[model samples]
Target: MQRGYFFSAEGGEGAGKSSIVSRLSEYLDSRGLEIITSREPGGIAIAEQIRSVILDKENTEMDGRTEALLYAAARRQHYVEKIVPTLNEGKSIICDRFIDSSLAYQGHARGLGIDKVLSINEFAIEDVFPDLTIYLDIDPEVGLRRINENADREINRLDLESLAFHRKVREGYLELVRRFPARIVKINANQKMDEVFEDVKQVFDRFLVSMGKLS
Candidate 1:
């Protein structure tokens, strides 16, 4: 049996990543595909524990390199405990976030250097990479506004970051898209959620067709 495809969604804060992941998962499920959805830094129990430390608003004293390492550690645990097993079962998976988030947030925004962060993640993930990444492109200001207006959304430590920091994160993600055009597809996320989902659906449909999973 063929190993299933691994897809990740990436973006800055409040880019509608969770919503998109949910819609995409449902769409794939309706097509009779065996699939699952997971998130980085918190998919499995161990990783979820790490996620709490990383996102805890009171942990403002966390060093930049330390933050990067924590993320890499969580990723390693998640990959071994959850992701690898799922793919081995021939079941496709959609992850809410993945290594790219590290490269963007810790790498670019934290001034740790993308290449350095990539090396850390390489050791953590052991070369397993996403087959495709759907990036929700949105203006940092607009995205943060959405976050502020959504009272139900959990405000993590990252959400408390300055606008300048979020801007840097978006810049980092855009750089990743430029570096990995074939693996990363950009979707305009400034529009209504329905419109954004349609754009994402088209990209997903084309991918299925290319794999001969659709007519």
Candidate 2:
């Protein structure tokens, strides 16, 4: 039986992660690959409820460690209920975010330390990490500006963070790239949508070829 692969996309707020994931999933599907798309902290019913609590604007009093724990809990459930079953059936999945977000947000930006947060997730996910992670590189300022201009986007607790906090988040993501060079690929998201999509496509095609999923 063929094995299913996992793919994840990570970026700071307003980095167009949703759009990129959608396009990438569509691209993969067109190539006759069976694929599914989901998001961390909110894929299944239980996880979605946890997502509401984590992102609620009223949860301003939540502590950094508490936030990290919540994310891990949600991830645990999502992985067990959704990810494992899908992969077992030999269907690839494209997740909007994954363990990287917790590592960057709660671990680095929230000052909990990446290793500490990673340890928590290590138990939550039981070592099932993504096969490939696409990191969308962008200027935090530009990303925030895009968020402000987009009225349709939901305003979450994380989005209310100060510019400095968001910049730290970006730094955390960069650090992750440095540490996990083999599993993560960085794509410039500061360009136009078409340009960003093309870059992501190139990286994705390369990944497929490397995995022997494509010639």
Candidate 3:
């Protein structure tokens, strides 16, 4: 039996993660690969409810710690209810964002302390970690501009944050890359869509070949 693989794409807002994920899913499907795709704070009904609470703009009084804990809770539920089962079934799981987003957004940018946030997440996820993580690298200013140019995007509370916070999120991801050099791969998201797709596909192809999933 082939082993299941988890591929997670992460980056700051407007980093084109969604586009890349969508394209990758299409590419994988075309190759007859069985895969499941999802995003943070969601992918399951219970987790979706939790996502609402976290992203709701009206909840302006939510404490920072409360936010962090809520995310971890949602993640735990999602993993147990959706991700783990899919993997157990021998299908690839591609996630739009995972614990790294929380470690960066809440832990580093929101002043919650990375260690504290990671501890809560450790409890939530135990030893279940992604097999591969792709970090979409982009300039903060350019990313923000893309967000602004796209009007159809939902205005999450986080989207209104100052530039400094987003910068810190990028820095946090860079630090994570340094710490986990082998598992995380960085892709230049600033490139054109076709180029970005090629970079992402190259990484996925390499992993599949190494695992003998591709002949």
Checking candidate 3 for backbone clashes, the offending pairs are none
Kindly list the per-residue Cα lDDT of model 3 for residues 1-215, writing each as its tens digit: 66577889999989999889999989887766788899998999999999999999888888989999999999999889888888888888899999999998899888988888999998999867899999998888988999999999877878878999899999989988897888899999888879988999999888878877676
What do the candidate models score in CA lDDT, each in turn? Answer: 0.95, 0.94, 0.89
Model 1 lDDT, full chain set: 0.95
TM-score of each: 0.99, 0.98, 0.95
By lDDT, the candidates rank as 1, 2, 3
> Judged by lDDT against the true structure, how good is candidate 3?
0.89
Clash count per candidate: 0, 0, 0
Q: Candidate 2, which ten residues in sequence have the lowest lDDT sum?
A: 204-213
lDDT of 1 by residue, 127-172 (tens): 8899999999999999999999999999999999999999999999
The better candidate by lDDT, 1 or 3, is 1
Candidate 2 structure quality by residue, lDDT tens digits, 39-105: 9889999999999999999999999999999999999999999999999999999999999999999
What's the distance in Å from true for residue 169, model 2? 0.2
Give me the runs in candidate 1 sitting further than 4 Å from their true place. none
At residue 17, candidate 1 shows an lDDT of 95
Task: Give stretches of model 2 more than 4 Å off.
Answer: none
